[model samples]
Target chain A: MTKKQIQEKIAFTVLTMTMFMVVIPTLLIIGYIIYKGIGTISWEFITAMPRKGMREGGILPAIVGTIYLVMGTIILALPLGVGSAIYLTEYAKQGKVTRLIRLAIMNLAGVPSVVYGLFGLGLFVYFLNIGTSILAGALTLACLILPVVITASEEALKSVPQSYREASLALGATKLQTIQKVVLPFAMPGILTGAILGIGRAAGETAPILLTVAAFFLPRLPKSIFDQAMALPYHLYIISTQVPNMPQGIQYGTALTLLGLVSIFFMLATVIRIKFKMANRA
Target chain B: MSKISVKDLNLFYGDFQALKNITLNIEEKKVTALIGPSGCGKSTFLRSLNRMNDLIDGVKIKGDLKLEEQDIYQKDVDVVALRRRVGMVFQKPNPFPKSIYENVAYGPRRYGIKTRKQLDEIVEKSLKKAALWEEVKDRLSKSALGLSGGQQQRLCIARALAMEPEVLLMDEPTSALDPIATAKIEELIVELKKEYTIVIVTHSMQQAARISDETAFFLMGEVVEVDTTQKIFTKPRDKRTEDYVTGRFG
Candidate 1:
């Protein structure tokens, strides 16, 4: 073989090996959890309330609580994040102020989730007098995912062709009207993708929920936004570490369930993104 | 009577001047063409007629511009209303990623034409006026992006026509089209002048001679000459206009 061909083959093999190093561990972890947890999963385990300190029965309350928190987080974050993105992309002039705002969003994304938990505890839980409830936890998760949503939404808005805006404006449409009729529709798929990704991240997050809303062993479903609830991630963490004599089967089962929940969110986002793409193409 | 008039107009992009002191009057229901080399301010002049230049940041305009004796540059001038009366077609075809019917209906819809019957009428009339109705009549519901480049350009014209503007601005509208499409657009321009005042910017001198009744030649951010298209093309005038028309230099 030629020297160049041999070098190209070596480079390709090295890249393949590097990719497998990342992929193998993820597959192994998921496979192990599914294998260990499959035995514990049953109709009763999913539907029945927890019994004997979460060691004997189901995680229905935790499942319900996670759903509530996700919905609340999406409600609080989607509008704020998308609005901020629109302002930055369309309305804000390119100057020092815009640059500063962009920098602040980037920094917010970098801050640790644990820091967000403390901020939520102090702000939403205590100062606001909302206490430890679904509202506080969802607010914290919303803050944690705000940067993701804003960045993704801004990217989506920026992807729209400048010509579309010009065409709308030239037709005598007002700036707001142009955005509503032309810009937003073109950017919808991207905006929804960002929101779905944010929800997925919020669903799997434990740190922000821990200090803000999660209860130690709440077996009852949350009755309202003001009530305390049990989330999948926090419940998994508690059973795996905090609870003594916790069965390996139960720990694996909780971890698998949390992973499955997050996977479901990811799959839903993918489906929605595909639907939008198909519509756009048509 | 003049449909639009400009006097001693100057435009600046920060420190760089894009248009120098210019004065001209555009006759009503006539085809007036602006011919120039690239960056000679012909397109800029066309955009200024409809105040499309205001979209750019750091753009500054000085002096008087009037549309039908109304001072368009005044603070109280309703830009949206002004734009509604002076519609513009871009150099390249830019049909919205929507059905052909929706693309043509977009302008009327913005003005609160909500009923489907009214929109259908406007869309049909506009498309027919643009010479694209027959080609797309059966597929009004199809995506406009699926059409060929020439069809798309005509669709854009139909979209602008739906606004029912008094003046139409074309900025090198045929530069991106093939000869056949270019001929079709030139024909459309000639036919359109009976109803609406038309100001078109063209890089092709032959196109200006063929389609416009009055022609203005721009050079280095200034209008060198304005006259009947025949006189500009045939007779001796400014040395620059003569050289530019003869293809001596840009």
Candidate 2:
């Protein structure tokens, strides 16, 4: 074979190997969790409350807590994020101040989740005196995912063609009317996808909820926003590391359940995005 | 009678001047064509008629521009009302990603014509005026994006007409269409001018000659000449206008 052909073959093999290297680890982790936890998973394990210090019973409380946290995060974050995104994209003038604000938002997305937990603890727990409750956790998680929602929503709003805005405005529609009648409708799908992605992220996040709302041993569902709750990610962390004599199957089962919950969110985002794209095409 | 008048109008995009001292009167119920080379401020001049230029930041305008007796640049002038009076169609077709019916009805609905009967009549009349009703009448509920390029351009025209504006500003409205579509739009322009005053910016000298009663030739951010289309195309005039009309240079 020619040297060039040989070199091409080698390059292709290396690239293919690198691509699989990324996928293989992810598949192995998921496979390992399922293999270890499949025997433990049952109808009772999902429906019943904890028994014997969460060593013997189901994870219903954790599941409920996660659902509540995710819903609250979405309720609090979606409107605020989408609103800020609309202002930045449609209303804010391009200037030094706007540029700085954009830069700050971009940087806020990169701030570690643990730092967000500390901030939430200080602000919501001590300053506001909401304490380590679901309210505090949701607020913390909302802040953690706000940057994601804002950034994604900003991208979605900006993706709308400039010509659409011009057409609406040229038709004698007021600025607000143009946005309401034309811009927002086209941008709705993108904004929803961004919000769903933020929800997915909020569901999987443990650090922000760890200090703000997650209970170490509480096995009951939260009655109100002010009550402490057990969440999937923190529950998994506690069972795997903090608890003594934790069963191998139970640990992997908790991991698998957390993965399943997060996967559901991601799947929802994909479905919504695809559904809107098809609607747009048709 | 003049439907609109401009006097010593100057427009600046930040520091760069785009339209310089453009003074002209657009006659009532006539097709007036603005023909010029690229970057000759024809499109900018067209956009200024409806205050569409106000959407761009750092844009500065100095001079008196009037739609009839109303100075449209006055502090209290309602831009929305001004736009309703002077509608615009873009160079490329920009129908909303909606059903054909919805696209046509969007303007009237926005102006508080919410009753279904009124909207239906307006949409039908506007589509018929734009020469697209017979073709699209069957699929009024179909997505406008499914239409071909020419159909989309006509849809845009129908959308603008739904507002019932006194003047329609078209900026190279058929630039993105093929020969057949361009011919169709030119025919629509001739027909539309019987009721609504029409101002169009076109690169095609033949198009201006075919549809326009009056023509203004702009060059380098200024109106080089304004006259009857026949005179501009046939008779002796400024050397630059002659050169541009005869394809000497852009």
DockQ of each: 0.69, 0.73
- Top candidate on DockQ is 2
Docking class of 2: medium
Put down candidate 2 lDDT per residue, B1-250, tens digits, no spaces: 9999999999999999999999999999999999999999999999989988898999999999999999999999999999999989999999888899999999888898989999999999999999999999999999999999999999999999999999999999999999999999999999999999999999898899999999999999999999989999997389999999999999
Candidate 2 chain B least-lDDT 10 residues: B228-237
A1-282, model 2: which lDDT tens digit per residue? 999999999999999999999999999999999999988888888888988878888989998899899989989998999899999989999789888988998898899999999999999999999999999999999998888888888888898899999999988888899988788777878888778778878988989999899998887778999999999999998988888887888888878887788788778768877777665655
Off by over 4 Å in 1: none
| lDDT by residue (tens digit), candidate 1, B1-250 | 8999999999999999999998998999999999988999999989999999999999999988999889898999999989999999998898888889988988898989999999999999999999999999999999999998888999999999999999999988999999999999999999999999999999998999999999999988999999989999999489989999999998
**Best prediction by lDDT:** 1
Give the count of colliding residue pairs in each prediction: 0, 0
Looking at model 1, what is the TM-score of chain A? 0.96
lDDT of 1 by residue, A1-282 (tens): 999999999999999999999999999999999999989988887777899989889999998899899989999999999999999999999899999999999999999999999999999999999999999999999999999999999999999998999998999899999888888888888998888889888998899999999998888888999999999999999998898888889888888888888778778778877776765655
